[model samples]
Target chain A: MSSEVRRIRYSPPWGDASIIGVAGSSGSGKTSLALAIVASLNLPWVVIMSMDSFYKPLNAEQSAIAFRNEYDFDSPEAIDFDILVDRLRDIKQGRVAEIPIYSFEKHNRIEKTTSIYSPHVLILEGIFALHDQRVLDLLDLKIFAEADADLCLSRRLVRDVKERGRDIEGCIKQWFGYVKPNFYKYVSPQREIADVIIPRGIENTVAISMVSGQIQKTLAHKSAQHQEQLQRLGKIAEDAPLSPNAIILPQTNQVKGIHTLLMDPKTSTEEYIFYFDRLVTLLVEKAVDFLPSHPEQVITPAGNVYMGLKTSVGTSAVVILRGGSAFETGLRRTIPDCRTGRILIQTNYRTGEPELHYRALPKNIAEDGLVLLLDPQMSSGGAALMAVRVLVDHGVPEDRIVFVTYLAGPVGVNRVLSVFPEVRVVVARMGDDMEERWVESRYLGC
Target chain B: MTDNTAPSQSVGPEYLPIGRKPTATVSTNLAHDNVTILPQTSQLIALLTMIRDKNTGRADFIFHSNRIIRLLVEEGLNHLPVVEHTITTPVGRTYSGVKFEGKICGVSIMRAGESMEQALRECCRSVRIGKILIQRDEETSKPKLYYDKLPEDIAERWVLLLDPMLATGGSALMAVEVLKSRGVPEDHILFLNLIASPEGAKNFAERFPKVRVVTAFVDMGLDEKNYIVPGLGDFGDRFYTM
Candidate 1:
């Protein structure tokens, strides 16, 4: 198998796993066929779990009857379905499961149990595997192994006599009395649910190969879909021209000086904080200019009317957490009475997906004439997108929201603008490289 | 002559100006871009602060309310349509300038809306004025139009719908319906208010998207009593000393 396929096969617990279930009556070679497929796949991450391990431990009287071939083990009621369903669900969710070990000779569970963790491929082989609805629901693929009734009985006779230490007459009588009747009643009916039927059981190598190929194709498709989603999230409009919705503050010497301090690697944390404050003030001031204003005339001290512009409405500011909080002081300084709200969004370290941890906005923030969305830095724009979605869902008008950031990449800004075109974006500086500083600081671990 | 044969491109039953699409399409939410919130100028903010203060007496309240309303009306008129014209300067040189286009009219939703009428008339002298008396049924909370007196040729004029407070937009919507019934196109109407709640503005825009909304400020939302919170309490009650 290719390394990419292997990576998926041994992916994290939350990753998708392909579950194949094989079902057939005794002596139908269901276990043998499952083993052959596993070996052919040559996947160390594949796990095979036999249904025999789910058999209910028998009482002394029941054990004696089972040993004497008087007790029927082929019935669905003979298996502990509750435990089996629980373990299957656990494995499906990438969790560890403890499977019981059953001894056929003792007709009971052994003292020890086998711990099974999540695997890329999970195979469940048994006569009643397809009988339970719960088990069938968890399986991605179901295969039924079939053989001639006479041939199955002959094989059963040989195996029971040698491996099981059962006499010929006893095996024959038990097969006719319990096994054959139960197989027709319960196990044979499950063929209707089988996705693929192998007529010759283990000897049907062609059918096994086809089932394996189908599973591999499904896995490949899932992997491709996951990659596409990641690409969509990370995509930035680098080559495309800047969107009209973006408002890059004019590169004045003061603005450039602040950027120099912010971008310098040798700048101390205190100096970085101070310079960021200065930059944020400028960004907030620029964003305020976007609000609607009207011309006004006021009497001057010289008894002359002077025409001026006056702001028309109130504004509210919503800051994204951590980095976004840097703009809080600047926003307050600019609009002292402006209501402030906060949204906490963090990137999951393992999954790299942004998660909203918390959000607190002023009551009736939706009605505010303007909402200033503050985030100091935007890399992939994933967190900003999520924050914007939150505001939009709360009935805030998209165009009324002005997303203010100190520094942003072209990709992040474009990503947000594409999703929310009407939302205005104001940034002090626009950079092409998103992760250069982080990489230099060893924050991203290269 | 009424051009009834003109193709109706508007989404609603009311006629809108040709070639002007509804502004709601600019965003999925209420058209915020079409709604202009005046900047927080110190003079305006100071007046608003005085009006919102509980300790302010009726005289001060009325004085500040009128000042703010006049400022808001002046600001609102700036959004009205204008046409270019040329005139001879005293120096005998031709000066080109823009002049207000179309006739101007104001329809006030009584009694809160009546407070803004004086300011609107002050700015547009000799402007045609109209009144719409829509009272909320205290029990039902539904607006019932009791009376309306609009201009005869209102369809050809730019009508400014004036109200001091837009809480639930029930009265504003009724007033707009009355205006549209009078044959005034939605695009030719501008809804001007001192303060509005988001819900009220959203509801109004969703119903009459082509009409522009110019407000001094938008408070949070209405309380259970349907009054705007942090709002200058009941503009009509405070202005009339009721």
Candidate 2:
């Protein structure tokens, strides 16, 4: 085994920096050094993406070369720079991406993929993360971890022989013929472009500490920016009209009866279900009022029925499950033909905060269709707000989302309205006052 | 053939185990081996460092414990079968890598276990999540199930049961029992925590050796009141600021 290198520890975990890239020659201890930095930072949102994850599939010509050991896998031409740029962009925007998993034993790509979700700190570590201009554009900090060519070769020799199932003679031959020359020609030339370069790779404790401190300072700055956005959301009033397209349902006495049953602390579970379903039916009916209507007539047994209203656009009800799912039963009762989609959003009871659990919506939801965002209750409105945000991000128009809740307190209604003014709020009842925590009694009951 | 006591002659420095692939391909599999299971005392030190400091507010306490719990779970998962895989990129490219052994799910004990969700999310993205809320029955002091939502494919996945503090292990036991009823294999279950009492660990060890316990700290004896001594107060209360 190659002698163990000294471990360098970075102070203060990697802060909320957008991009941090690691670059080095073929066997320069880049992986080991990058891992040390990631471990020391201990940032949960950090994603260590490898440039090897972007290797180009072999063509007939390249496959023949690979078989003959004639292909230069270390060359920059070996990677897919477009996809690398795309993945980096997705990471920066805090979205999800399907990262490729590679295999060298068979010299082909594998079937299984890893889903990398929103990372707060993105650690792009690979040979070409810094070499390619397109890839480097996405990096906020560029680090080049360099080691002695002979030392790296020895580590590679041990690693290949013991771990990779390679023969000693073949490993040495490949290291000398292809790997070393590629490093000098393609990888080493990019060193001058790096913001920071370290000798002895991870063995340099001083370098690692300096990098860690810089990461912490960057993260502290980001946390402040996030706080500011949340503060702005706090200032926006809950009940304000979200947008001109908002379709507020008219309150009626039958609705009041349902609300009474829902709001009463003395209500039994049976009574709660009954009123909840009744309100759901009413909310579904009111949501239908927002869709485009076409002229139609109903036939009666005794005589021809007069012309009446019918929906023009196909309607789809997407329930944010389990609470919103309860509304599905009522939606079916009102419109038996309506298609249903489920999005699970659960509340962290302690923080009273909501998180997206699961979501499976229709592919064409954004294509001129009416979507009912049904929830049994909305309090603090975070889940409902996020649910709407998800749909919006997925291309569903804000006006297309009609939020129908059985009951909503002032706080939740205000939250949804403020975040998405164009979203319609239809409910059996809306409470006036919010508790100290901003949750209404009716919402709490649900 | 080499003598029995001799360092082998066949395994040389360049003895590649399989093919002409680079050593970097296999280096990743052994990266996390430096894992050390901190003793119960060390865990207490780590926890007390966070909770005892006047600077450690309710938010920071919950945050740091969550961080510690995530590491514990990741360490446990390291022992799983993560075979090397290859995948095609969206641009029709190929990449080689290693992935988790199987599908994973989280079953949290209501209240306390729920606080650990953010950390779990940070660790595994797009993980199919489930919940089992069982509170101690005030009258009987036995666990009473209030709510549960698990994926249909939960039986096929390894389940991680999360609870911040395990004192008597009653709630955790009940949760495991419930998951088994749902068809989760006993061996497929891993119980994770920020701190655990010996009584709970012993209870778990005796009841199901098949189930692994991944905890940051296994504290000394439980208090007369059944609280983990040097515990970070009532986890749920502290988490919710009650």
Task: Name the top TM-score candidate.
Answer: 2
Where is model 2 more than 4 Å wrong at Cα? Answer: A1-17, A27-44, A94-117, A147-173, A196-220, A234-249, A288-368, A374-383, A409-421, A432-446, B1-242
lDDT of 1 by residue, B1-242 (tens): 11112111112101113233221101012346668775544345445656765556787777667756765665667667655545542223343444555777998888888888776654455788899999878888788999888888888989899998887899998898888888898998898888777778888888888888888776655666676655667688878864
Q: Write the per-residue lDDT of candidate 2 for residues A286-324, one digit (tens) a residue.
A: 566556433333332212222223335677878887766
For model 1, state the Cα shift of residue B55 in Å. 16
Quality class of the docking in candidate 1, CAPRI style:
incorrect
The weakest ten consecutive residues by lDDT in model 1 chain A span A1-10
Q: What docking tier does model 2 reach?
A: incorrect
For this target, which candidate reaches the highest lDDT against the unseen true structure? Answer: 1
